[model samples]
Target: MPMPEQADAAKSRAPSPAVDRGLTVIERLVTADEEMTLTALAKATRIPLATCASIVYTLEQRGYAARRVVGRSHFWRPTLRLYGLASQLVRKIDLSSVAQPELRALADAVDMPAHIGVLDGATVVYVAKAATAGFIQFDTYPGKVSPFNLTALGRAIAAYLPEDELAPLLTGLVGGRGPAAGDGSAAAFRELLETVRSRGYAVEDQEEQAEVACVAAPFFDAEGRVAGAVGVTGFARDLVDERRDKAAAGVRQVAATVSQRLGCPATALPRPETVF
Candidate 1:
C-alpha cells in the first residue's frame, strides 16, 4: 500500500480529467449571466456538445443543475448545491446557542412566537423557537421541518438565495402560502419572492395557516452568506395594519441584530413593510 502522506497528496490532486471537466462545466454554467443552450454552452466553454450534454446529465442527477422557466429562458441553471456546499463550512456553528436568547427577545418584543431556522435540503428546519406567553398545543417547535417554498420563514431564507436556486423550488409550490389558493400558484409565488428580495423580508399573511401570520428576515453569517432566518408568528387578526408593520420591522431588526452578533458587518437597515 502507498504511505499515508502519499495517499493524502494523491487525494488532494485532481483525481481524473473527468472530475476536472465536471468542475469546469459547473463553473461555466454558474458564471454565465444567463442560461445557455447546448450550442451556447459549447461556444462559451469550447467543450464538445456530447460531452457537455453528459456533464449536464450528471449535474442534474446530483441536483446541481436544474432547468428553469421562472425568470429567464427554459435552460439549465445552477442549483442550491453551491449554497449547501458552502454552508458546510458553518457546520460547527451552534446556531441554537448563538440565537436562542435573541429569539426570545424578538418574541417578547413583538408579543408573538418566533423561530430560528436553517436550510436543510429543500426545507428549513427550526433550530430554536420562542412562543408567546400563554401559548399551548403548538405544532411548530425545534426540529420542525417546513418546506422552503411554503412558509414565511422558508421564503425568508429563500429570498437571499440566488434566483437560480429559488426558481426550481418555487415551481413546486401548489396551494400558495395560505387558503387563497385560487389565484396563488407557481407564478404568484415567484412574484412573492421578488417582493421579498426587494423588501429584504418575507410575509406570510395567513398564507399557510388559517389563523397565523408571520413576518421574517434572513440573517447572514461570518462569511456574509445567509446562515438562516428568523420570523415571528401570531394570530392573523392581531397582525393587521400598524401591528403588522411593527412586527415586520421588529423581526427585521432582530434578524439584523442577530446577524451582527454572528459577525456580519453592520449595514443599513431594511425599509419597513407590513405583513399584510
Candidate 2:
C-alpha cells in the first residue's frame, strides 16, 4: 500500500549481502556448462568484476578453485580435491577403519590377501587390506580400482549402486560376451544385481585373473546402505572344494562382524557359507 516511489526507493535502498554473492559464485563455478571465466563468474553472480577476482583468488588459495591457461584470459574449474572432500563427507560411518583388525585376522585365517573397498563413483577403491605370508601373495594397496564385472568385491559393491548409475557401466555383455545387438538383455544384468543383493555374497572365479579367485560379502552402514565390501582373494588352483566353502564362510563372518561394528542391523546381514 505504500507509494510507488517509496516502494521503489525502499527496494533500491535494500543492502545487498556478501554471503549470497560468494555462494552464488561458488555454485556457478561448480555447475557451469563449461569452464568459467573471471568475467563470466562476476556477471553470473552479479558481483563487481574486481570483487570476483579477489574471491576467486581466495578460493584458489584454499584449493577449491583451479585456474588454467586456456588462452589470454584464464579459465577455472574444480579439482579432484572436491571429490575427496565429498567422499569423506558422504561416509558418515567408517567401515574401512573399523574392519582393520578383522581384515588382519581373516588374512591370517585364509592365509591369503583380504581387502576392504568402498564404491567410489563407479569403481571399488581399496580402503584397507592385509596380506598373508604366502609365496604368491597379491598386493592390495589403498585406492586400487577394481573392475565391476571382473572381481568379487567389485560386484558386491556395484550391486548396491543406484540403478541409473549401475546401468551405463554394465550396458553391454551377453553371457560374458560384449553387449549384444538390441537384445533387451540389460534386464539380466539387473537380475544379477538382485541376485547379489539377495544372496548376500558374490564370487569371482578367475574373472580378474586367469589363476585368481575371490569371494566377497557386503558391509552395511548405520543407515543399512552397502557401505563397502570385505573379501579374500587367492589363487584358484590353491583352493580345493574343502577350502572354498571355508574361505567363503570366513569372509562372510568377518564382513558381518565389521557391519555390526559399524551399527548395521543384525537382520540385515546374509547367512554364512552361501555364495552368490
Task: Kindly list the per-residue Cα lDDT of model 2 for residues 1-276, writing each as its tens digit.
Answer: 999999999989875576667677877887888888888888888899998998888889988889998669999877667778767755765656776777888888778788888776656788888878756657577778865666678778778877677778776432322222123366755676688778777777664556778888778875687777888888777665877777778778888888788777899776675422
lDDT of each: 0.77, 0.75
List candidate 2 segments past 4 Å from native.
Answer: 1-93, 172-188, 271-276
Model 2 whole-model lDDT (C-alpha atoms): 0.75
Q: What TM-score does model 2 achieve against the real structure?
A: 0.58
Model 1, 69-164: lDDT tens digits are: 556544888898888986784675677777677677777877888888888868889988888778453578899997776677888888777778
**lDDT, candidate 2, residue 157?**
77
C-alpha RMSD in Å of predicted model 1 compared with the true structure: 13.0
Q: What residue pairs are clashing in model 1?
A: 177-207, 177-208, 178-207
TM-score of each: 0.61, 0.58
